[model samples]
Target: MAGSRKIELTEALALGSEWRHMCFAILYAPDPRMLFGRIPLRYAVLMEMRFDGRLGFPGGFVNSQKRTLEDGLNRELLTKLGEAASAFSVERTEYRNSHAEDTTHVVAHFYAKRLTLEQLEAVEAGAPKAKDHGLEVLGLVRVPLYTLRDGVGGLPAFLENSFIGAAREVLLEALRDLELVEPGSVLNFKRHSFRQPSLNS
Candidate 1:
């Protein structure tokens, strides 16, 4: 095979028939006004959904006919953002979850895109009010890297999703990579504490 890794999707009826395999972006943008201006950080986070009625990244599941997860995610982003795939950079792929009941798992491909203040303003000015999913995404919101520690508040509910946990990790990792947070000083918020269980469960 030309690629060293591959993904396969399957329906797990026993696990509420939820199909495995998905992708997400850890969208980031450098902001200089926050945290007393001591840290040059990026806005990595969730946006309020316009259709699904939740917050999430600009991504989706791989089409069965697609050869790669990146392809599917790129397509979804373009469809939603009206931009080209080259507009963003794939930072890293993080393993979010794996199913033991079946040979299926979910992976989030975290992407990083730098936007200027003017670009951000323009994006906000002309962004679509909603996506094909009918989700009225209230545009992208910066994940507060400073408030990511314990006892902090204002985290979006969708960030607590089990599927998006990897996205969170990617955010943390990116923060660390950017020297915004010290190594090994990141917080671990419990997913179950905030996330609702599957309806069928």
Candidate 2:
């Protein structure tokens, strides 16, 4: 069940009360800015550089026994981000999909929200001052939403970094489904096997 994908939010929330729930979000905005007057920056997708040196979205496990999933996610946002987190509106309708880590009896729910460039910038500016700064979250990392002329930079190059848990797949699918990255680009990741090279070779 670890490999299961695309479960609807309703189906996921309806599961037997034995499963644990974790939530994360892809906070993005239309970045109509450019660098050096060329190569439009396109969009700003926010992720976190965790204290563990792995990349992930800004959220954590929620106790469904108390708060609803979205409330739990926003609660995490308030801690990982500062007062700027209040600007986020992640309703149940924005729910993307769920992933089953049946081995651990945990299911992760993903969400995506589009914000104004100003609001997105606020989240970045306030992050360093958040309660979890340098503890659980090292800092905010923006996903490169562009491909360079050489065709290997931007998203492709960014993909080389390590992602936490199923965050990598969560990112690729979010980009493809949101029409931010071409389907081919997501397919090219090919399950992200990091094969070690032999010293003799």
Candidate 3:
């Protein structure tokens, strides 16, 4: 019955409405050899539209008619990625709200899924053909732990803007569920400007 609450697009627009949020899993595979003694794991982030270009995860708003957040996300993934969605398993989720100081109350639900190396390969191979809402995703980025460190400076434009917090939270949850990352491995970074640092002499 809850899913039956149909908020028409026109009404939603009038109310400055918000839509459902979704994301795909960033999986890591352990590698036996690494110079820093850190686990060699494969990481993934979504390629979405931003001022700069495509970044972030594969997700979007939930259809009001769906029973759960997962239902909506799964539907969108399947629709956009086609058989690529079949390669991974969605393992966990988290829910939160937007921090914007506006009347439009927004709720976001993030999900994490794990895929085999072969599955990841399939996704990479299929990304060129995937399209959602007329946007063509560039595909997932395999981030290394050192990249999060190495004083590399910043995240991608879309990740910096949209799902930075959610990304850390969901990745931690996924790692914990899989017993991969340590309990505190997920570090929440403070919000910082993505603009290039000024070099005032």
Candidate 4:
């Protein structure tokens, strides 16, 4: 959090040779499927419930000395999404934002890619069998792209849950950037009623 500030992807890539790079992305599909025969599942975005009990996108560190950022990112995708990730790719053109954390000599890169519904499902189905499953990657979380009748559930509720670092920021930016959700709509969420979680839930 020291030397970190939002900068162009190219600028981040051009940093002096002292920085390490970590890349992550938001994988989403054009989902027209209906939920419970009523609610429309507009966009299916994948986020992981990390081992640390925080939510973040599916990806990991990329050693520039070993592989290109895109290649390293794909390698991580394969590890986290299992064989289903074979067909998915995140190109450099999809790069979104980059922030440099000078304190640790690390720079974070964010990406967003679109997949078909079928392809997305394959990733989801195969995630449980991925190499990092249940370890660094605890579970797959599909962002609820819609709001309930009272505007208090779905995305709003999902927002209430904890997110790690820039996960929440990237998610909101992607939602608006992709036109999956209208701009400024996320801020109008109604607060949810307080309820205790069940031990069995």
The prediction achieving the highest TM-score against the true structure is 4
Model 4 lDDT tens row, 1-201? 333678787788788888888889899999887988999888899999999888999888888887889999999999988999998789989988987776787888898999998998999899999999988999898999988898677887788777777777778878877888766675554323434345596
Compare candidates 1 and 2 on lDDT and give the better one: 2
What would the TM-scores of all predictions be? 0.54, 0.87, 0.55, 0.88
Alpha carbon lDDT of each predicted model: 0.47, 0.84, 0.46, 0.84
Worst 10 residues of 3 by lDDT: 95-104
Q: Which ten residues in a row are the worst by lDDT in model 1?
A: 1-10
For every candidate in turn, the CA RMSD to the true structure comes to 7.9, 3.0, 7.9, 3.8
Give a tens-digit lDDT track for model 2, residues 26-68. 9999887886689777788999999888899998889887989
Q: Name the runs in model 4 displaced over 4 angstroms.
A: 1-4, 187-201
Q: On residues 45-115, what C-alpha lDDT tens digit does candidate 3 reach at each position?
A: 33444223434456565654444555676766765665677665454343222212133243344454555
For residues 75-163, what per-residue lDDT tens digits would candidate 1 score against the true structure? 66665555433455443253232222233443334455555555554444445542442344545555555543344443434345443
- Residue 75 CA error for candidate 4 (Å)? 0.4
lDDT of 2 at 175: 86
> Which of the two, 1 or 4, has more TM-score?
4
Q: After superposition, how far is residue 198 of candidate 4 from its true place, in Å?
A: 18
